[model samples]
Target: MEEKAKSFEELKPMLRPTGVEPGIMKVDPEKCTSCGLCIQNCPFKCLEMDEDEHPKMKSGCVCISCSNCIVACPVDALSIERVYTVKGGFFDTETPAVKMPMPPKDADGTPAEWNEVERVVLERRSVRHYKKKPVPEPLLTRVLEAGRFAPSGGNHQPWKFTVVTDPEFIAELEATLHGFWSGVYPVFNNDETVMNMVGVVETGVFDPRTQYGIRCIALKELPVYLGAPVIVYMGAHTKLNNPALTIGICGQNMNIVANSLGLGACWTNFGAVPLNAMPELKQRLGFGEEWTVVTALVLGYPKFKQFGMVARHYRPVTWFRPGTKTPQTEK
Candidate 1:
């Protein structure tokens, strides 16, 4: 048997921070024919070749270990080794990169046409006001297909979308949602514990009790889905791994697809809140045994023209650095 070369760990360098450590990318010389795809796709420009044409990291170079080079390597010559203080690991094919179409590009290599999917995502908004118009059956089916195609944990594909368009049913949904808020309003009024937990952001002008009261009263005046002709009830089994998240993921895909089809859509947790007290709703909404409602989508034409970009902020992000020691306590 041919003996293998000693690995990076054989160098025994002092490891980086406790929780986050450096990930080294290794290339097998025999497997690589120096095609140079890895060199082209390296985002950090960490990979280079020697006189023998074997890809290696430049002297004193550090890899952020994003694994772009590994994913772009057609021959699988590049391997990423995530080094931890106690252990090292690799990612599955799913974790490496996703397969998707190339975006339309300009002559200058800048994206020429803003991608339709990208535009839909950036422009999507939670449309509260909708015209009393129905979504066509064909369009609705396309949106459901988007949900059906969403990725799931372990390929369980555990998502069922029940679409309700009947006026009487929407009325019942409105009543149940109102009842939930009405019931909660009293609790917030009476229970200090519940009040503290509510922590309702005084978003515009009302206190927690006031907001709940306002919502309950508004629900009584408005039909469910705000007169939108479609209500999509997203349901999933509770036994699967983080099933609620799969339902949410399906819903996100559905909503974006809806927007692309010229339909306005928004998801609501309040729609499912009533199910806690109204078990009969489970049967009416087609939530079978072992299935629970996760979220809901209301779809229709926008009542008012929505144009212009809205300012938004993202949550804080921390980038881990290589060769730096960061002390963090395990929870």
Candidate 2:
């Protein structure tokens, strides 16, 4: 009986959705590139590429609103928004004029110049390997506190944050992340290899592999994650309006806060992929049935290397319609 009970416990579900609403992450199919970036970054595995070659939310309890999809989108097209509502509201609502606060005007009654935010966005690098040093607790607390104050829809304030500093837990999470990479490697970028009579077949179709794969290699090769010594896991309210947007705002806020504190941080959805695949991992991290993983940012000191922004390569900007001054037919 004891052994049977233990087996059942091992097989038990780690979480269950409240069903008050069918939780989902809405992906704009028209803007989708089938890049799989969102799918790879989603901590809850709530997103997967569909037959239409668009992202689809596959799990009811998988959305954690880490906002990785929004940042990873090559085109400023993808956004993370709520899938369901506990209380039905207007589906098509305009921005309420009443909610607007009139800024102090110029002497001519024109609005004043835009005020800059306290925080500035940094040129963030996707840091894979760390130096295996621990981040200071006070600094980590300050980062979380910055997230705690992020804006929400109608002040829903439904976000939850859990920080894991335990080395064993971090190691376990890393193992799960590696497991995810091992499984998804073949699917991403067409890396499937078939074995024949030889020891093993080799397929190098996907060049450079994934950033995470490269990071795994760096962890072995160089002191990357640069011994920052800490990993911060962010969890957000999955049911809020534009949950992805809110989480993005909050996550960026945390990043800026960290930057201001003289600490370096890198945001990635690598940790989330495995957490989504295995529920027990979520439970172990202290998330109940109702919550989801939004994103994970590895924090640490840098290897004294400065990675600045690169020149942005982009398609030409096109306008919807040509000026009326010129006819449709061009010279």
Candidate 3:
């Protein structure tokens, strides 16, 4: 067998940090309302209310600077102060060269025209039907690169992509999930008592469409992965701040890049739900206990061409202005 060339990690020198410091949580007492939203939203649960009902970090707790507390503060009372710095490592101080040129602009420095990126974003769709043609390795690599460049909280970049192209393995995984769902479909379908016992109805989460989709998946009518030739499993470190959110951003980048490459891509939670439940299967797939299957994307050539901007449902938006006492609502 031919030996592979040096990998990217192999070619780069390892960087060892000399020291590390976590971010400090800061609270504005005047702006704080003792709502406890910041404390409730902190992933680490390292925050507590002081005697005056002000939020403060608990002793022996370190902030990873995920910024969840800041975002959850409706009155903007909380913030994280501190920068991540490293020294005494084989780190490059010089700025790297820009690989891509800037977007074209008009004389006034505004966008010149409706660009390709905008067009691609507008025309992108969740493709369900796919052709049998396999996605090329180079195109798949580009999609992974797009995901790799996605921004993460505190620049942690805590994500791993597993590309599966093996037809037999994909089929086996699909069949296993289908079997599990098939066994539970009867309880999920006919037995309202069981569904109620599971708190599905009490939570006001019962939806006919969701049940129908589940039925299709259980019956193997929906083909959990849509029979795509390539599946990208995205896993992330759960300890990091907002791992799901980071994975979502990374998946979006991959989907957009897949669309640009004339490939159909669909984000699927079907596989993730089942795979996460199966610890042995997850371990076999090389995911450690610390990492979780955040989501997956199926990629393939579309059976039919889909283009042009699609109409989307409008959502209510509220805008707050400096001069306005009440915020303006757009419906």
All models, RMSD in angstroms = 21.5, 17.3, 20.8
Give the CA lDDT, 0 to 100, for residue 320 in model 3.
Answer: 90
Best by lDDT: 3
- Compare candidates 1 and 3 on lDDT and give the better one: 3
After superposition, candidate 3 runs with Cα above 4 Å error: 1-113, 190-205
* Pairs of residues clashing in candidate 3: none
Which regions of candidate 1 deviate over 4 angstroms? Answer: 1-113, 192-224, 320-331
lDDT sort, best first = 3, 1, 2
* Cα-based TM-score, every candidate: 0.57, 0.50, 0.62
Which residue runs does candidate 2 get wrong by more than 4 Å? 1-124, 187-228, 307-309, 313-331
lDDT by residue (tens digit), candidate 1, 4-105: 644435311211111223346789998998988667554345578888998888654334454556655667798765421222322111222222334668
| Model 3 lDDT at residue 271 | 73
Candidate 3 deviation (Cα RMSD): 20.8
Candidate 1 TM-score, true structure as reference: 0.57
